[model samples]
Target: MTSIGGAEMVDWNLAVATATRLVRPGPEVGRDEARAIVAELREHARSAEEHVRGYTRMFGEDADGAAAPHDTPVLVVDRPGWVRANVAGFRAVLTPLLEKMQERRSALPGGAVLGAVGGKVTGVELGMLLSFLATRVLGQYETFAPPSFDLPAGTSAGRLLLVAPNIVHVERELDVDPHDFRLWVCLHEETHRTQFTAVPWLRDHLESEIHAFLAETDVDPSTLLERLHEAGQSMTGGRASGEDGEGSAAESRSLVEVVQTPAQREILGRLTAVMSLLEGHADYVMDGVGPEVVPSVGEIREKFQQRRAKGAGRLDQALRRLLGLDAKLRQYRDGERFVRHVVDRVGMAGFNRVWTSPNTLPTKVEIAKPADWIARVHGDAGN
Candidate 1:
């Protein structure tokens, strides 16, 4: 093991070891080979180091009160043990659905589904699947250009921070039939990736809103100061009262809780809407694409929905506590319903055309009023 700045150097071997422990074997490769592949993946990591530094410089802290460029650390965890474990868990839940997708793809009339039919086990394959799905969903939007998925680890995989670009990180946990479930996962991630890629402005928009929210974070410094002052006064008065008790010391301890400002709430509401739209689009695409190919598509879809609903409990709570936002499953449902209504009324072309401009996209109001959106779409078509 090498050391950089007292941190143990994470080479390909260590990366391989970490991955083997985290991921179970899929159809594509075995445990030993997985490690070897991860070893090869280290080369990419070295090249990505410069870019990682660049990202850090932009997103990292700087003196002189000047903001960094990116302000986010792009970590290439050759051994992201926890993330790999989570990926594996997600794979276990998604396996049955993936198998169904493969069977369904085999039965398709033509080669409409090309790349997706194969089981996805490698990083490149995963990237390809995501790219393909993104292209399919947001391909029509002129401004919606898919980002290069094959960039070195530190580089952006679209807008997502690539914690593990190689299979070494999360491959073992992935236990689905490569042909089916991997396709589904690819679709889910790519749905998000494509939205950001196609609508370039959306990435900046979301980040700006989040920054605005954070900037206005109303953590009352004065409250803490006041508490300290009170504690000081109590300590001085304690000599006169002869009440310097044990519980008195505990009472002096104070904590400051950060409350969300109005700006944060407004920004969070918009973010919720965007997230809902993204999830909704993925659900709709999965439904539209899977039924024709996968026999158990509906079952897989239901299972996924149930899994998401269950997972949302923790996610919703965490978001509300940390960011003052709720990850609304209902919002996703409503957004899906809205998109589906548009598709039903005007067809895929019309529904997809909505991405042509930022203005054409639905507002938070339109998410609730699917019928109104439908009427508007129909009315526009009539014009």
Candidate 2:
């Protein structure tokens, strides 16, 4: 990979190439079949956006202060294309942090060569991770446009990305109605778009939290690798693998230790709460749209969940645990419960006040106990 300005931190091209190489070829669906699938998806894309936004309007406030723009064109891609796109997205997100880490590395011995090796390792690991993840993510609502993501010309700032092959795979495997499942997936992804666009502050808010997280931490390459290893186990109760270095010690520390400082806790806690809300709200809205809109809603929820819980090979399971994907799996249940509980006690209108300001967002404890959040926000009875 070529270095930029002689100080490249992530070697993004290497990451993309690595991911593309590692990605397994999909089942041999024919070109005509594939083309038909894309055509149908593309046709539904516009209506999916309208239906999703329409439902979102019924449930939450406009996040962007204006009508959420409809200009973000939907693009369909194969699994490898999805991997490259996400590698691009992660580059945009991770570059700043990598640069900060690079600055900290300048003080160490064996700077340039060490940095090159570090960049290579990081790029490879990132590629490996994205290759695995690309198959898993159904759709993504990309809020910020990074030039490197190479989004198509004339598309809007906010866009929805769909993995066409994955969509086809899931529909056939689940034996669910293809049209219904495709629309269902679109509804969920579009809700994500509406959430960020509705609350215009959300994108910047998440970016700022990321920036703070980067500023507060410093790590060498080996330690950073070790930490990524630990993040995989974080969802479970396993200890992160590490030895005596300061960064290693941080990795070895439990989630509590990592969030020990007020500043770190504030940042992590806010991120957790916000993600939970966004996810939960989207799940809630997806369901709220109901059986009328998606007749297989109940079945899709049930078998799709079973599909989610289906075990993989031993190594894949290990990777999922290490990735903290188990924790991500939990967010759906936890977030939806919080949203359901809140709306149950106060009704949707009162719950809408949560969007009024960041202060009203549920804390981790509050998510577990809706009555407490209700009382705090509305002086209703405490849990």
Q: Rate the local accuracy (lDDT) of all candidates.
A: 0.42, 0.70
Could you give me the TM-score of model 2 versus the true structure?
A: 0.83
Q: Pick the candidate with the highest lDDT.
A: 2
Using all chains and alpha carbons, the TM-scores for the candidates as numbered come to 0.47, 0.83
Model 2 misplacement above 4 A = 1-7, 58-69, 148-157, 227-262, 380-383
Number of clashing residue pairs, candidate 1: 19
What is candidate 2's lDDT per residue for 165-203, written digit by digit as tens?
788778888999888888888777777877766665667
Q: Clashes per prediction?
A: 19, 7
Please provide, for model 1 over 208-313, each residue's C-alpha lDDT reduced to its tens digit, 9 standing for 90 to 100: 6555655555543234234333432332232211234433321322222233467766776666666677768766765665554444566656765665455433
* Cα error, candidate 1, residue 126 (Å): 28
Looking at model 1, which ten-residue stretch has the lowest summed lDDT? 135-144
Candidate 2: 10-residue stretch with minimal lDDT: 242-251
